[model samples]
Target: MSSTNERMFTRRDFFKFSGAFGAAAGLAVAVSACAPADTNSSAGQASTGADASALNEDGTITAAISYELGTNGYDPMVTSAALTVAANWHTLEGLTEIDAATGETYAALASSMPTANGTTAEVQLREGAKFHDGTDVTAEDVVFSFQRVLDPANNSLYASFIPFITDVTAKDDRTVEFTLAHEVGVFADRLAVVKIVPKAAVEADPDAFSANPVGTGPYRMTENGANKTIRFERFDDYTGPRPARAAKMEWQIIPDPSTRTNALQSKTVQAIDSVPYLSIDQLKATDTVESVQGFGLLFAMFNNEAGNPFADVRNRQAFLYAIDMGKVIQTGLSDQATPATSFLHEEHPNYKRAANVYSFDQARARELFAETGLTKMRLLCTDHDWVRKCTPLIQESLVAAGIEVEFTEKKSADVYNTIDGVPGAYDVVIAPGDPSVFGTDPDLLMRWWYAADTWTDTRMHWKGTAEYEQLQTILAEGLEATDSATQEQKWGEAFDLISEAVPLYPLFHRKTPTAWDGTTLVDFKPISVTGLTFVGVGSTK
Candidate 1:
């Protein structure tokens, strides 16, 4: 097995980009926003009800996201946050999509499941679908989108998803073919998340395309730039079910939670994406706003490369035992989080919640420290407000357990860049993993922990063992197995082995607290991974 210290990029490194996965493939097309010349029969005029100016006459919804957009050129290939924002503008009907009801995969873009022909997968394009540029969407576009992500030079973050596919060819205008390098399951689910971009539009001007992306989705990017508000207008020509409400959507970048809360209270912004946990109670009490929990993990990741104390299993386990998870969840997290027992979230299907592995036992932690003979270590984390609040709580807990704790907080970019390039920056860092619609797939989990070259697979640096290898094999095979029971059993086995080893001390899963003005915004549903969807949201009175 390759040593975890190897500086190769692996699937685990892809997790950071998973939040914005698939948005990187297509080119942006300049959409003509001006009303068409032919007043009676123009595409825009025909789609917009007789009263075109009053399309969204009710009101507009404004949102605040934590990060700044367009810093990475709005290219999905390099920018994750931009990819997420772009997802609202494009559509890729995949062979399977997450069933909103059961969170299971179901057919969406494809008419039926691909046959088990090791070489080829077939898909039929949905009829009458047209890009925002008024170009008809065909199977050719879908084939091109998938192939683009797999391009080695493009360095698309989600390249691993389709690494097994050798070719994507258009069988006909409405039909496409995929030739696989190997037999793989979950292919459709992976494709479902990929947003298809227009080939002609991207080829026109790749740089300009990022800002003016065009897609067949319900909304279109009307205006966008760095630090400036991103505006999305409803696509009048959208072929899907008409959205419940018509409204213009705006995403304003606001880094400070206090400022965001003030905007919410003052009715300046209709909704805020990540309401700081500290402000949840205050927001909940306000009659003008409603707070909702977001689905994501909040945990500490230990780097176990050479010279790092976390390289020792005993030390890692000791750190876990020293931390008081309950208090951290209550005080640091504002009851919006639950003590995490495993990598998988409780809401996920096939999730086997493990019992507390390292329940706050200062005595055991001290004993482990003595056995390991480790000294004081610095825990590295970002200087973000939440991390700042959480890390100190962890420091206090560890200190009580006879461990001297030091901290080094840097900007978010510096933290990710340093950890990605340099192996041993600090012993442990606070991190979060957002799984794309959970399933019992070890490919992502094992890849995250054991993949030799991944920046995010810090555990692999220290805890690579024969047992870990065996569990990974079991997980890989189970995900490919068609039988649900066998898959569950295999997942259970892997979960048990991982919990026993405690390579990653499950800290807590965060419930993203978001506050939205209910009176102004209508039909708002806070999703699990991404925050607000502008598709069904609209302004009230």
Candidate 2:
């Protein structure tokens, strides 16, 4: 594969030329101002054999997701909200994609695997592919989409996910090439992080384009809805492996878990995500509910900035020993979650037991606290319904260890913002995360928090520490290694260093519980991460 003289857009050029979007920005306005339509549809006739109901009269599927979609609009270049990206997963695509449930790699916009030689990959696009607007997908569109994400002015949240790609170019009408800065272990798996978008439509009216996404996937937007709801209809012209099984799809942004459960029980919505832990047995007895185990884990992170008690290793270890993680998983999360023995779950191919572990020992916790002479700490937790349920248990444990804890709760986005900015205000934070949603390979999962100057270095305040430097060296060696065995060994070395330092440690990897009427749908299965997948799924009606 040879490189072409395709135009490149760097971060610096984006700042200098961003003013050109003024006309398009001004021309852009809310495409739909109407409130989100009713989240549920009326119940139809019940079905037999499987625990499901008949499909809607119009043959549409209503899905209620617990997360909000308004934070970042539908634009692939900028959106970071997990649910927003998942919704677009059906409408938009990339050269390659990692299956959400199976973590298997498959071709999407491109025809086959890219032929890689060192730092470059050659990819051929699928022939005759057309966007929802009926325009042929061209090589120019592929090149332009990569440039936008690589451009720094856009500040795409997903930009850090693909740090290896140095440049991208189109070879011809049907082929494209990617140039990586260095050979990474999971370079191909990370391509799906950025979905390809049409250059002409986006450049013409970026805001309106986001409001109404146009892609080569199986679905097309019926309305340019925002905030509360987004609706889509099948693209009759789509020529892909997973075409739309239903005529229409409606996603209602319901933030409350109870509301979503009610919507599913009433048969108003065909499926719902984030099944409440308490309602799992009830739902499973009467309907279709599953608790799929994946990389979804709640991590306990410490802010090791100067003057904070957590900066001292003794303080950090003391906090971990005080709380019974097993109890947290059992009482708050039920049996759906497993206490994490290693950062990589046991099922992962690269799984390894950590070098050190945190176990319940109230006496050891008090001793460590006494060594630090610290008796009070401010604990920050996400305001998600289930997560909030775990805080009281944590508080009780800490109080039992003779430590006073002040708890504060906020939305998931708000909690991350405080940690990302005001590092001194918080001593500890417990939040749920799943990097495997992007790719299940161990390299991608570890790189999410351990890669240099990423979350662990910047947000967690461990940049200058000795353990941080050791972890970076391990990662660099892992990335450079060509053999799988060598890569696994390097990652294990990094995990050992992390286990000893304890900047942020996993409590447990919880199973993602999802409820849907199986009798009414075919090929529908629950996912382990934040997003809900409906590809290849159809209504029984």
Instruction: Note the residue pairs that clash in candidate 2.
Output: none
**What is candidate 2's lDDT per residue for 262-285, written digit by digit as tens?**
888888888888889999888887
Tell me how candidate 1 scores on lDDT.
Answer: 0.56
Q: Candidates' TM-scores?
A: 0.78, 0.86
lDDT of 2: 0.71
lDDT of 1 by residue, 335-429 (tens): 76767666555644457866445577888889998898986887876655565678888888888877777877765555665666566667787
Could you tell me which residue pairs clash in candidate 1?
8-453, 27-202, 294-512
Looking at model 2, report the run of 10 residues with the lowest lDDT sum.
Answer: 23-32
RMSD (Cα, Å) of model 2: 9.0
Q: Global lDDT of each model?
A: 0.56, 0.71
What's the CA RMSD for each of the models?
A: 10.7, 9.0
